[model samples]
Each structure stands twice: as C-alpha cells, then as structure tokens.
Target: MQRALLIAAVCVAAVALWLWGFGGAEHVTVWAAEGQRAAQNAMARGLRSLRAGDPGALTALLGLCFAYGVSHAAGPGHGKILIGGYGLAARVPLTRLCTLAVASSLAQAASAVALVYTGVLLLNWSRSYMQSLADSLMAPLSYGAIGLIGVWLVLRGLRKLAARNGDDGHGHDHNCNHAHGPTAQQAGAVRSLRDAFVLVGAVALRPCTGALFLLIITWRMGLAWQGIAGAVAMGLGTASVTLVVAAASVTLREGTLARIAAGPATTRALGLVEALAGATIAALALQLLLRAL
Candidate 1:
C-alpha cells in the first residue's frame, strides 16, 4: 500500500511539473526567452555591420545565429516536446531519431526563408502578413496535427494491450505454432516511419521567429545571402541541441524496456504508460489549440 501510494504521489508530481513548467505554452521559460533576446541583439548588431559594408561581420553574425539556434531550441517549444515525448514512448533508432531532429529543424529554417523570400519577391506580400500567417494559421494547424498524432498513439497502445489480453490463454504454444497477430515490436516499427513524418511536419510547419526576423532585416539591407547563411547555421545549432536530448530519451526508454519481463503485468504497465504519454501530449496540444482559436 505504501509503495502504491508513493508511486501515485510521484506520478501526480511529474504530471504537475510537466503541465505547469514543461508543457505550458504560457511558460516559455526565462532561459529560453533570454537566449532569444540575446540572439535578437546579435542579429541586430550583425545586420548593422553588414549594411555598413563590413564583410567581416558576416562570420560573427553566423556564429551568433548558431548560438541563437541552440538557445531557441532549448526553449519550451512543440518540436522539442514532441520529439522527446515520442522518444519516450516509441522505440525508434537513435540515428533515425536524430536524423528526424536535424531534418525538422532545418526544414523550419528553410520554411521561414522560403516563405519570406517568396512572399516579398514574387507575391508582393507584406512581412506583417507573413508573420500573421505563421502565428495565426500555421501554428494552430501544427498543434492540431500534434493532437491527432496523440490520438493515434493512444489507439495503437490500446490495440496492443487488447491483443496481449486476448492471447493470454494461448501463451504457451501459440507463439511456437499458431501464428498470432502483429507483435508489439513489429507494430511499433511499422508506424515508426509514419510517426517520424508526422513529427517532422509538426515541427517544420512552425517558423522560427529569429530566422524570420533576420531574413527580413537582411533582405531589406540587401544582404539576403548573409541571412540565409545565418539561418542555416542556426538550424544546425538547434539540431545539435535536439539530437542530444533525443539521444538521452532514446537511451533511457530503451534501457527501461530492456529490463521489463514478458509477463502480463509488465506488458500491461507498458501499455498504460504509452497511453498516458499520448494523453499528456494530446491534452497539452489541445490546450494550445483552444487558446489559438
């Protein structure tokens, strides 16, 4: 009874911490905001020098952009949360997970530059309009997609749980002779790529504010090339941060799974945890969606 009570207490505390600190969009966190501010300062300085024809400033600007990327990534954003949470629930390869992180970050940088450049140069849309679309439209869409992914995860977990329960009586010879439905491992792998795609889309669709700011300033100053370079550097830095976090999550989750036995109790526990993670993610995302609407 004590053990159960203790576990319940810990779970409650964890959920509170996540929802209050890690999960809340309102609490963007002081450190991340500071990093963002520092990056903005660096970008402003870099833009000023580049406009003054000091070509040497470009190198310094790129370095600051990278720093900004790292810091921006450290913030409480949907990308990091989704990646880390998925890593906790799924058994994706570390390399593949890291690959997705890098790709998604770069995609965000690319999207910001692409949208801005295209809007300003080709479509003749104002920068304000572009920013508005990113905040009002793209962000909500991404959050909505994240909620849907959560639902999918929950459904998959429930199905696995049901399958295991159904096969409880035939546990002895069913595996050796009678073919069963998809094993957990097989089912997880089948959707691994699909999950990666959804997460990538969720992250990529949201533009980085710093990247957009730099692009707009540089474009106006006739140094679009420098802006592009800096944006790439920032994306790389963000990817680096995300990769480290994801690697840790993957290692921890895999290690935990490795220790669990094939017994029904353990299997049931795994299913519940998976479903709970999905529920947490979905609830957080839904909160954001509601706020947006």
Candidate 2:
C-alpha cells in the first residue's frame, strides 16, 4: 500500500512538471521571451561587428550564436516536447536518447544551412520567401510528423498491453513456436533505431529561424564558412539543454519504474505510462498544427 501511494505521488509530480514545462506559465513565458529578444539583439550586433572587419569579431559572433541557441532552447519548443515525451513513453537507453537529442539538433542546423544555400544560390530566393516557406510549409509538416510519432507510440503501447493480456502465467506465449528468428531484443533495437531517425527527421524539417538569420547575414557578408561553423556551434548549445531534458525524463521514468514491484503490475504501469505520454504528445502536436495552419 505504501509503495502504491508512493508511485501515485511520483506520477502526480511528474505530470505536474510536464504541465509546468509545456503549458508556458505566464512568468516563465515572459522571462523566456525577454531572454530570446535580448539574445537576438546581441546576435545582430555581433554580425555587424563581423561585417566591419573588426578583430576577434568572428569569435564574438560565434559565442553570441551559441548563446542565442541556449536562450531559444530554454523556451518551450518542439524538440523538448518530443524528447521529453519519448523519454517518458519508451524504455530507450539514456545514452541512445542523448545521442538522438544531439543528432536532432545538429540535423536541424544542417537543414537551415541547406535551405539557405539552396534558396540563395540556386533558386535566387529572398530571405523573406525562404522564411515564409519554412514557417508555412515545413512547420506544419514537422508537426504532422511529430503527431505521427505520437500515434506510433500509442499503438505500440496498446499492442504491448494486448500482448500482456494474452500472456500465460509462465511469462511466455502459449501459442509460440520455437522457430529460429531474430530475437525480440534485436527487433526492438531495430525499431528503436528507426524511431530515432524519424525523430531526427521531424526536428530537421523545421529549421531554426535564428540559424536561418545567421546564415543569411553571414552569406551576405561573404562569411559563409563562419556561418556554417556558427550554426554548428549553435546546434551544440541547443543540444546541451535538450540533453538535460532527456536525462531528467529518463531518470524520472526509471525512478518510477523502480518504485513499482516487479510483476504484471509493473508491466501494466509501463504500458499505461507510454499510452498517457503518447496521448499527451499527440494532443500537443494537434494543437500546434492547428495554430501553424
């Protein structure tokens, strides 16, 4: 009874934390907005210094870009949403999830680079047009992809629950044949890898506006290489925050699971957690998509 009560309390705490993070409490939202504006202003100044051929300007600009990334990521964003949700919903290894966070951040940066260069060099598209494309088309597509991920998680959880319901008391399926095939662990690893790719893709589809701005300004100033480097540095900075979120979510999830007694109850709890997390993610994605559209 005590264990159950403890588990309930932990679950409640987790949900509260999630809500506080995602729901954008007025104070937090105001602080984040202010920080972002300040960081963006500093970045613009750094770009001007670089353009003036000032010594050490490159270093300062890169530093500002990194800071901008950190400030931007501190706000409620899709990357955090996806990473935190997946961490809670799935039994992904901590190292793997952290890797995914970094990969997704870097991929997002790369997408910005690709989009800017492609538009400016090949298509002769203006900055406003490119930004509009990203905001209008890519944003919706990314949200849709995230929604699909949520649906995938929901279905996976439901299937696991169904399988558990069909399990005999011996912890093995009674209808199973002893046929040679890839082990369940191997299959799971494959699926996890695929999911990681999808997560990265979803994030990459929506390039960071800051990155796009940096790239365009640097490109106009004939510092394309520096822009690339700054974009990468910014990605690292963003990854730092997402990594923290990933770690926290995993720790919370594992801590909760540890509190549960090892039995069918634990299995059911895992399924329920996954389903609930997935449902929340899907709902959030739907809301974002609607707003974007």
Candidate 3:
C-alpha cells in the first residue's frame, strides 16, 4: 500500500541523516595534523578575545547555527534522518513530536558546548593525560550514543504499530507518547517560572556533532573556553529550525497522517524502513568499533 511505501522512504531518510550530519571522513578536508593545529590556534585566538565580552558568545551562536544548519542540509546521513523523521511526522501529530525533537536537539547541542568549555580546564589540569583520555573516549561515546538513538527510533516506531492489530497497509493512525512516571495532567500544567527553567534544563541533553566538533577544535587550539560559546551557538542553531517546525506542527491541520501512523499491519510494512536504518547504524558503529579496536 502507499502507506507501506512511505515507511521505506522514511527509513531511508533516517539513514541519510546520520551520513549527512556526522557520517564519514571523506567530507573532512583537513588532514589530522592540520586540523589539530587549526584547533589549537583557534582556541588560542578564542581565549585572547574572551575579554571582548559577549561578542565571542554571539559569534559562537552564529557559528553553531551555521554549522548545524549546513550539516543538517548537506550531510547525507543526517539529511536522511530528517527526511525520515519528517515522513513519520506526516503520520503523527507534529506538534507533540516536534517538542521531542526540540528537546533532543537542544540537549545534543548544549552537551557539545559544555564539553568544549570543559576542554580548557581538562587541558590545564592534566594536558597529555586529559588529551589521551578524551581521544580514547569521545569518538566511541559519540558513536555509541548516536547508534543508540537510531535503535530507539526503530523501537519506538515498532511499538506504535504493535499496540493495535487493526490498521495495516503500511501506516497507522495512532498518537504515541511514552513517558516515565506520571501523566501530564497529574503533574499539573501550571506555568511556574521554576518549572520552565527545569524544562529548559531537561531540554539540553541530546548529543550533537556541532558541539563535539567545536570541542575537538577548541581542545586542539588550547583555548577551551571557546567551546562553551560554540555549544550555546549550536543549541541556538538547531533550535532555529526545530522550533519553527514544532510551532508549525502545532498550528497545522491533523490529517490522514494520524490514521496510518500505527497498528500490526503497518508495523510489518514499516519493517524495511527500520531495517535500513538499523543496518546503516550498525555498519557505521561496527566500522568505528573496528577502527578503535
């Protein structure tokens, strides 16, 4: 059915996002040594300018947005994921899911920024040891986190379809929101400033390449504080697109997407999409693991 076909398309998009966003050495023009030096120099430059005040933060924010947008648009792997997620968006209430996307994106971008800032203190504290520690840990950890995300998406999709056996033909019409603890109503929807801040805090945990790359560059530059700017910038950049999409999803009409977004029949049909994404992630993860080994 047409719905089933859409699943395949969605799966391809997911795999593509990874490739586009953070996939491969081929896209990198800087040789390892050159990159290392550039990073070191940039960090040095960044530190001297810290006294320049908010400019560094402003520039960092712009740089992050530019970097993330470019990566999202041009990175084949990441592009695929965006497309695939969009496809899924067609099936679900975009507003709800967009919140999740924003939450995740912000988390990823913020984490990257935080790590970059930490690079300075880390370097100052132990130099060679810290560098060694980071080198040994960062790549594997990033790859593992990304791979886990892919797995989570596949599983979530499957679960949506599994809940009911009624719908078939590829997509189901279901609204799926899985959360731990209590329901929203029980938690109270009151608008408290502390609650808002807590929500914002929770939103900044997703892993992001922009933050990661910025950190790497800063660490190499030896001006670790620059990384914090980069992180904030990255978060803003991701939010630019994500927040717009979320708002649009909220305002948009809830159409047939809700119908085909679920059920056992749709689950079986959507399997190929899941498989493709899984295979791509697994392959990439294996390659990284092997290289590490």
Candidate 4:
C-alpha cells in the first residue's frame, strides 16, 4: 500500500511537471495558449468600451476584467509555477494555500497599478517607457526571485529527506511532521508565512502587461478610477485560477499522505514531491530568464 501510494503521488507530480515544463503534449500547450490569447483580446476590447463612457460601461468593464483575469491567469507568465510548486512540497492546509494565492494575485495587480501610477503621475514618463521599464527591469527581477526560491525549496526538501534518513535507529517520532489539526499539535513544519511572502513577491515583481496597457489607456483617457477598478478585477480573475492550481497541488499531497500507511514513507514521498516541484520551478524560471535576456 505504501509503495502504491507513493507511485500514485509520483505519477501525479510527473504529469504536472511534464505538462508545464515547456515540452508537454503539444495539443495541451496550443489549446491553453490560444485560450489565454483570446481572453486577452476580449479584455482589450472591453477596455475600449469602458473608456468610451457609455451607459453601464463600468459594470460591463468590471465583468470583462474579471473574465480577462481568469483567462489571463489560465494562460502563462503569472506565478502558476510558484503556486503549484509550493503546493506540491508544503504539507500546508489547502485553504491557507488558496488564501495565499489570492493575496499574491492581488499583490501583483497592486504592483502594476503602483508602477503605472508612479510613471504617469509622479515621474511623468510616457506609457511606452513604463512598459519598457517593466519588461526590462521588473520582469528580470521577478524571474530571478522565482528561480532563487525554487532552488531554496529544492535544497530544503533534500535536507529534510537526508535528515530523515540519518535518523537511522534513533527511533525518534516519525509522525513529528504530521503537525496538523487542532490543539498544540499543529505542526508548523508545513506552514511558513515567510514562504508565502516570498511567493507573493515572486509574482508581484513583474506587472502584468494587460494591467499596464489597460491602465495607460484609462489614465490617458482621464478615467483613473476605472483603471484602478479594472486592475482589481484582473487580480480577482487571476486569483481564481491560481487557487485552482494550488488546490490541485494540495490534493495530491494530501492523497499521498492519506494512502501511504507508513508514517516514514509518507514523509519520504512528500520530500520527493517537494524536490521535483522545486526542480521544475527552477527550470521554468531559467527558461523564462534566458528568453528575457
């Protein structure tokens, strides 16, 4: 049973890594990317209408922005990898993980608004220049942070596994890591607010292009509030998709823990998942960085 559960968990992780690591099944890639692009196009058109100030345009714009956020998140270049990767490794509660995803997505939107606002109002830089600045400076920093976090996760997972192995005949509490549920038994091992902040920072580093474009349009059109509201809509859309990914990651880990009867084996399996997730994240970040450079 232990081996079977471990195999299942490993298979789930493998499939996710394959699909997201750049060279998954070709059809999956095309369909997902195309869908994302379509959503982006729809969002662009919606922005135009909202800017025209027709009756009910504000509500319509908000709806469209929400939809766009969902699709945009579904596409790529957000922080799906980070969210998903952390999900695989951490034994954290799925609910908390989902909440973090929401926070991170909102932070990303806020970053976009702050950047564009600073450029247009405070610095007097034009739209084109702001976009360029984000593309060049902010994008790299975001990718770099993601890559570093991935490496950190990988190292942490490896160390955990190694220390577990070194336990040898020590006969320490194997279930020490199972610190969940009520009471003082809540193991803080699986949860880390620092990690949440880092992951949020990773996504927030790069402002979304759509947010930048839409904001610039609204600002130029003298509808700054619309731009702010639209940005929030985008964040909500992104949070929805991100939460789904985070949920999946949590489910897999939980399943593995539940199915594997042996406490020690469960810990080992989790470590393996964490290690794989970290490697995938690092690889994806490097790929993005290289392309950006």
Which candidate has the top score in TM-score?
2
**Largest lDDT belongs to which candidate?**
2
lDDT string for model 2 (5-94, tens) is: 456557756765765766645555577678778878888888788878899998988887788788778876788889988988887778
Q: Give lDDT tens digits, candidate 4, residues 82-120.
A: 898888777777788898899989999999999999887
Q: Worst lDDT window (10 residues) for model 2?
A: 179-188
Q: How accurate is candidate 1 locally (lDDT)?
A: 0.77
Error of 1 at 217 (Å): 1.2
Quick one: RMSD of model 1? 4.8
For 75-160, candidate 1 gives per-residue lDDT tens digits of 76777767766766665677877888898899989989998899899999887898888889988998898888778778766876
Local distance difference test, each candidate? 0.77, 0.82, 0.45, 0.78
Q: Give the Å error, residue 5, model 2.
A: 16
- Candidate 1: residue 132 lDDT (0-100): 89
Clashing pairs in 2: none
Question: How well does each candidate superpose onto the true structure, as a TM-score?
Answer: 0.84, 0.86, 0.46, 0.83
Error of 4 at 98 (Å): 0.3
Steric collisions counted per model: 0, 0, 37, 1
